[model samples]
Target: MTTPFVHPYLPNSAPEVRAEMLAAVGAESVEEFYADIPAALRLTGDLDLPEPLVAEADLSRHVRGILGKNRTRLSFLGAGTYHHHVPAVVDEVIGRSEFLTAYAGEPYEDHGRFQALFEYASLLAELLEVEVVNVPTYDSLQATATALSMAVRATGRTRILVASDVRADVLSKVEDFIRPYASLEHVPTVDGIADVAAVTALLGDDVAAVWVSTPSATGAVETAMTQLAEATHAVGGLLVAQTDPIGLGVLTPPAAQGADITCGDIQSLGIHAWFGGGHAGFVGVADDPRLVMEMPHRLFGLASTSVEGEYGFGDVAWDRTAFAHREEGKEWVGTAAALWGIAAGVYLALMGPQGMVELGETLLARTAYARKVLTALPGVSEADGAVHLREFVLHLPRPAAEVVEELRAKEIEAGVVLGEHELLVCVTEMTTQADIDLLARELGAVLGTATDATTHTPVLEEVAR
Candidate 1:
């Protein structure tokens, strides 16, 4: 059977027209084009795909029906990406054609685009309390790897130390990029935060940098960063911070802690998790020109013009990207992700400093309430002793994966399952007190042996680290 050209945008060519084109190309059949693909590897049957819809309305409804099946859960799951409440105006401003367009450094056609990104970097710099911030990278993982690369370049060292509890995805990316060039080391964590004592023990002349993630994998805020920074610097190594941009609203800025390079995902600012839709990454440089010069991606700078009080946005150290010169570029990232950077800038401009602090306080409050409520359950107890802000670990009577599936049946996204025993639950500004109460009730109901949610687990005092 012949393949049906069904999409309205795709023109259906007549058999004679196809024959004429093939004849012109000196080929008798379409199969001739695939002669080099190896007969055994070629598919033997028609693709088992649904027929395409001809009407735009039909296509829209069809897609909607598929998406409608995704249960809008009362979610508490944040292993990394989170579901934050995105304000309405952020989408409105970014959707405008002036800001929505994509490219790298088009000085003439898209000066507004350049300026938007500049404002984003500037606002993020202020929020992070760092001197300089780059235009976004792909995600936190990409930013971490890129930051590590810059550290190695700046310090001229072959050994790098990573906190074992830093997100596994980030470590894998850093390892992928740094291998065959630099050696990798781990600084272990105790009670969900990096063990600062071990970090001091591990730092040496051969080490180029130390990386630690705040509001770490278990959602425990790593408070010992200041000590880690001092130790890394005493040995002449840079401190690289893997952070959540939203956490900076309330937490100490890495720069204040003496971080040489700070990097992470900015997804929580205005971007939605969108069920793992792509997000942009960020890297902020401390007050060092050498490290600033080695930044992996674009850095938009504000400039003053000859006209009185006139200003503009442009690339600083304009030669850093692969856009103009691919082979010799520092990194191969493109400019589309910068669009997310622009959206984030809009978010910051709207939130301002006060809004950021308010957001942080709100998250802190909600998570605290959640931890208090959840731990009251009979079979659920705090998995670690760390004081958490946005997330916490819980030990359940049964397998967390099994519990998660039961919760899913009740329309809840739940938390990350570490194994048969542990569950990493996250709370955000979006998770209301009612949602937390419902979560407590559901977990109590699903565990089969749970008493009412108000009953404290008997081991609470024993595991209350």
Candidate 2:
């Protein structure tokens, strides 16, 4: 019997099939179709592509086998994403068809989703100590860009001053989004925090907003936030703070610290680190009607039902969303991460105010202990030279990537590589004293000096009590 007309993996790509397609398109060759293009632009070689899988494949099992090859190393690596523990309940709720099915912002279709997102926003408002909170804007990084856009639009200015210490990738994304609409200037940092003196000097009338971060990229809590807010206010610029909602438990919420606007990721609450996604972004402001109207996403508010006492949720100021007015809407993220927003609401509802506070404290104590254990190695210096929280930057003598590679050999994913000698390390509730010790011991071995067992402090015992 003749072999079926097929490519190894793409079954429809046999030579005979290609010929028929070419004939239908009135072309002798694939190259002949684009023959009008200049010779210099045309490729001179076959495309370098991966070899297709064998046709005799149990596709699902094969895919799983390939996926299973991925090593589940003990991780200390949180630069762009985190490794917070997700309660089984979060997934149990998010996985249900109702929450997962409602991506469109259709209040009529799924009233429960709207109410859940409303609860999420309300919870965020309470946590940040701000009056307004948006559901989600793509992700935390894009939410930051959206927040800055709001500041620039609100002030009617054409320039933005972003802190140099904001995550490099987030900064780049914000710069890309805002370049056509406004000019960007970066304020330098010293010791992993925004330099207050430098920030104050750069504020001017043309500046729309000054963007700063708390527990900044290096994991050091930004101490100059209040002063920066004041300086920005003095020059008629709003202070936009990018923060982690989890950090607000042990640290001051941005609103309380004089920020005019606050934006951040709420992944640490109960969202799993499914790589760079499944986390929601939030934009918040004080109780200002003008600011409320400027928010780019949907807003849900509670109202009294027909009974006059019972409450029901409904759209608050939704004319601002793209759905209400497509051509002249705030921004179109109507279908993006809407489910994650609902999931976040479930997380907040499950955790409650006291749970959030306790989680924050646990992270603080645990991270502090981890830092003490890791930084004890000779020649290791902390890059973030302030009150580091949750995450920290360590400067080692050897290249970070190389050290991390050596650690990975022992099934330990040490941290993120920031530079040749810099590693960005993160510690969360999931990170234990034994985990910290393993990282230190392996890191020390990689650095050419094994840690002395007797001298190594008992981090778990010391912190647990």
Per TM-score, the best of the predicted structures is 1
Span of 10 residues, lowest total lDDT, candidate 2: 453-462
- Total backbone clashes of candidate 1, pairs 3 or more residues apart or in separate chains: 1
Query: Listing every candidate in turn, what is its Cα RMSD in Å to the true structure after a full C-alpha superposition?
Result: 6.2, 7.0
Q: Estimate, for each residue in 1-465, the C-alpha lDDT of model 1 and write its tens digit.
A: 165354557553666667778889999788888889988898988679987587899999999999998766677888778888788888888888766655543665677887877888889999888888887888888888888888888889988887637777777788888886787887778988888888888889888999888878788887788888899999889998888889777878877888888888888989978788758888998757798778757777777877779777677877766765687877775654777787788899999888989999999889889888888887789877776878888899889999999988877867988768899889888777767777888788888755565653321123223
Q: Write the per-residue lDDT of candidate 2 for residues 313-337, one digit (tens) a residue.
A: 7777778878788879877746667
Q: What is the C-alpha lDDT of each candidate?
A: 0.80, 0.80
TM-score of 2: 0.83
Local lDDT at 170 for model 2: 85
TM-score of each: 0.85, 0.83
Question: In lDDT terms, which candidate is top?
Answer: 1
Query: What are the runs in model 1 whose C-alpha is more than 4 Å off?
Result: 1-52, 102-105, 449-465
Against the true structure, candidate 1 has what lDDT? 0.80
